[model samples]
Target: MSVNVITYDVGTTGIKTCIFEISDTIKLITAAVEGYQLYIEENGGAEQDLKEIWNAMCSTTIKVIDNSKISPGSIQGISFCSQMQGLVLVDKNGEPVRRLMSYMDQRARRELKEGMGNGLKISGVNFLKLLKSIKITGAVAASVKDPVWKYNWVKRNEPENFKRVHKWLDVKEYLIFKCTGNFIMTKDSAFGTMLFDIRKGKNCFSSKMCKLLGVNMEHLPQIAGCSDKVGLLTEKAAVQLHLKAGTPVFGGGGDASLIGVGAGAVSMGSTHIYSGTSGWVSTVVNKRVLDITSMIASIIGADDNSYNYFAELETAGKCLEWVKNHLALDEINIYLQKICVSDSLESLYVNLYDFMLEEIKNIPAGSHGVIFTPWLHGNRCPFEDSLARGMFFNISLETGKRDLIHAVMEGICYHLRWQLEAQRKKIKTSKAIRFVGGGALSPLTCQTMSDILGCEIETVDSPQNAGALGAAVIVAVGLGILERMEDADKLIKVKEVYVPNTANKEIHDRNFIVFKSLYKNNKRAFRIINK
Candidate 1:
């Protein structure tokens, strides 16, 4: 029998609720998104209101169910995957004690330095600390974004609130608690905390590491496997979400881990690239691995027995949004006024993204020698530099607005290429990489990435919903509807394939060389400028 499931993808920018029909193939019946604000401050503060996030999740779930015209009783399971490394503290009542510190937040830099001391910094942990972390956890990032640092930030800065905390939950665990009334953390989510022993034979929270961070063991949530059935949806949560009471709720995973499963990259060496508000390239691997120099490491995969080697980029499609808000004044004014100049103009404003994609199509490759660096937010992988800033290089008098736009898109691809090479150093990535995220919506960008990487790229249906689909697949596996996570390979349907354009190979290769050199030449200067 076929099963329908609701998979909530709680992302950095918003929450996307996707309803899937899991049968011979997984089909997205419908989806709805509700956005919430990330309270970002100039002093490296990025936070989200937990109450607002929960409300968005409830509302979007209802919207998706109503829009899909599906019966709530027909839904067999519900699960979730969310942005990783966020620190969410909750009291005994399972209510958030404070606004969440986002994975993007860097306010804990000072604390991270204190804990790890000054050494060759990669992922927050220094050389000595990283070796220790690798010996225990299989991965470690000492960045301010790591949950442990965020926890310390709270302990030092918000002691009153921290003292009231009953449990430490990542975004996914909080959502799971809301649905199932179970305070459980998935193994994949635990990986982001830098507190888990990610070693293949010992994937559990490390008590020694907790002591190192001066954290109480009781504050951590109970760890569960990704496919473990935590509990059933409580009657209270079901009423709010308009779903059937007692539906099985499975522990999903961290967004990066689930994205691999969602894109059917569960097999070893299979690779996938995701571009959302943030971006990453993840490959499934047989065992744990860590590359401190490249700032890439194997985090826990959705499959309990495996790992996902991932490289992160702080911004991807978000760069386009930056352009829309700052560079596209005319487009913004039209949007603000809601004025219709013509029927086509109305359509253009309504679907400005489609218009942008069409514009990108007309622009030729290489952006006529203009190169853009997509580091609007400091980079995370392939070299962790918080000071790196985005730039447009090799611009000339002949460069047009279209060239600038195309260059920005190309810049993101270049960053992805850099990340890919870093991961390639540790593992054998698949020749054909799967693409999933908002960026995959653009045929031009997909093709550009193919040419830039000199490899084949595959995008699947509703690519941006990969995280959601992966969550549902996890639920299915937990409920015995599917035999294993690998069954996802048969369920995922590819939308299109983009092959390398040999015609643009020479120019892109040259541009990539310049891209790598740009960073090496500017590292010291970046620190000076940002400092």
Candidate 2:
């Protein structure tokens, strides 16, 4: 018998609702997307309205269900794969205490300093605290953007709201509560807080780390496995989503945990590159590891007794989105009008990006010495610098607009290669890495990534829905359609593969060296300019 499930892949800027029919293999039935704003404050604050996000999820869910012509009763379960590290505080009524504090928010500088500051340090974090956290969680929140620091910021700055906090949760946890009316945080989301005792089997929140970090243990919610059935759909959520009242709701995971599964990188030592709004290089590992120098760590995964050594870039496809608006607005507008004047063409922004990429395929690798940095919203992993801003370097009078465009893409790929190399330092990554995300929809991007990273790039069908597909897999496991999460690779099939082009190796190699130096050489200057 075929089983159908719904998954919401909640991203930084939007939510993607996908329906999948899982039987012998996973099949995408219908998908719908709705975008919400990431409200940016002047004081290094970033937030999203929980109501808006919830509404978007509801709207997309209804759309996908109606569009697919599938009986809503047939949907076995609903799950989510959300952006990690967000701070959402809920009260007794299960409503958000405040606007959701985004993972992009970096206003916790004061809390970060007071907690992990100057006296004795390791990798810029307090030495003793780092050791304790590494021992307990196998990770440390050296980056100010972590949920712990955000939790600290609210406690000190918004004391009244802090008093009202009933439970602390991440992005997925908030939605999971809204759907099932149960307070739960998936294990992967718990691990992302840098407070969960990875060494402990269950009830793993570490008192030592939480006490040292000043987070109240009472506010932590009960932990659930990624595929564990949290509860049935609440009557209110069912009405809003046009689904059955008692549909099972599963404990979905964070993007970092499940996107790899969607890309079919589920087995141990399987590596994948995800280039979405934000991007990362993640390798599934059997044992936990930590790299403080590179800000990379093997975090708990959705699968039992597994981990992914994850390295991230804050802005990957976001950089491409940036260039589309600022650098190639004219070309984009013209292309949109040529295809369809309405939002239909524009809604599929990846198509516009592919149109642009098609225009620059012949622009040569490395953009003829012009280089761009993918740090428009700052950077993470390898170097944690919010002051870092993007730039187009080595631009000469001879440089054309196309060259600049190509440079922006090469710059993004170079950053990915840099991260992949960092993971290689601790573990062996697959030579032919699976590249999945909206960015992977472009053949030129696949080829460019393969060329710049000097490896084969593999892509799967519906690459853009990899996160949601991964979530569907979790739901399938929960519903007994699949035996385990590890069976994900058996369902997903590779659609295409690209091999590296040896001819462009020299230029990319030379530019990548300069690209690596851009930060080290200019980090001090970046702080000065951005400050």
Candidate 3:
């Protein structure tokens, strides 16, 4: 009577593998995390080692099964939720041709500009092309961070690689192919490419948009339904993962979509905020919506025949990682080395984030007038400015490390607040928004988000595991273990609720005006200085 599913959540910074019991109320049996390095270079180049990612996935899956003492045979299926917009090119042999270009990469700014020049004029995209794109896709951003730009960049810069590429797969699809020997991606993953007819909600590429973008559609993979079983796990992959062979592999979804499902946002009009490496404010909606000005747009959702209205911030937990690496690592290394830890750097890096959260709890809202910008790698939503840079404005002599730290957290919350405001312009949001992500694990961030946004913030147990759970839920639905994805509402148990602090509302409101103006005031300057 015991049935389980292993879901792998492949995020930008790492992979988290979780095992879930398939039932009326899904239970998370156990989980394990495996980390990887992101190679970031000047002029907006960010990449990941694809081989290491596969290794991380396999190792983490083994760790979860071994740690939980669960029988691999009991696992009815396997699925995935992965970071969207990353481009992974593979050869005819299904081997990675090169490292993946991350969603964080902004190298195609020039190309995006060239596309939207006198021949066209829609800021990031061509005006005429934009019209058709908006009509069919429901959303279109001609940014270098999008997979289309990455594909174009590869074709232009590495012509040899482009010719050799047998398929252009998103991160999740690459992993799926590794397990099932099928080159496939879900509608949600394809939506991230900005080359799909989102309005039609088709599980295939858009030839019209591809023609406009000058992208060869031949390189793309076949699109599949979010919960459709793609194929059975291969014997080779089963041996590597220490799992049973012939396990069903379902077509999972993009990280944001799955996270929405995992956060119990399966019903229309339900909303949730996820802060992982990147962050977003997403709401499930029945109708397609697009707001290019506010950068709030519709993308394919994990649930069948649904869409998600969202605005994304490119950096969230990533900013915190920046702080840890640049600001706190030295002190942490010394402390850990004193404790005789062999790998002090890694040890401090892994365990110090929770410590940082504990320290942030004592700081008040607004960080005592020290406002930080969470745009270290530029922003994607509430505006489409890639040249924007992160800053800790209004720092005074009285400011301390705690203030700087809290400001970073508050800065991310402020951006989310901006996104929430933009999303409210289109539709009604839920009374209480659920929060899920690795970043959502921090009580301080949740409280800060609630205080700044003036809304109730709900947290579920294992917030970091939301994407993984969502992927498993999709598998359960595909296998008829669950009737509907909406049942996630009953499956997800709310572990905590963060109420807004009324006393701090005035400062947040006052600072929000300043926060809103800071970008506009510096827009020209950022373009000049950064470019």
For model 1, residues 213-262, the per-residue Cα lDDT tens digits are 77788998888988888999999999999999989898888888888788
Of the two candidates 2 and 3, the one with more favorable lDDT, higher being better, is 2
Query: Which candidate number would show the highest TM-score if scored against the true structure?
Result: 2
- Model 3 has a clash total of 0
Runs in model 2 deviating more than 4 A are 200-203, 330-350
Among these predictions, the greatest lDDT belongs to 2
Ten residues in a row with the worst lDDT in model 1?
331-340
In model 2, pairs of residues that clash are none
Question: If scored against the real structure, what TM-score would every candidate get?
Answer: 0.95, 0.96, 0.95
Question: Global lDDT of each model?
Answer: 0.85, 0.91, 0.86
Query: What shift in Å separates residue 26 of candidate 1 from its native position after superposition?
Result: 1.2
C-alpha lDDT (0 to 100) for residue 360 of candidate 1: 66
Total clashes in model 1, counting residue pairs 3 or more apart in sequence or in different chains:
5
Q: What lDDT, from 0 to 1, does candidate 1 have?
A: 0.85
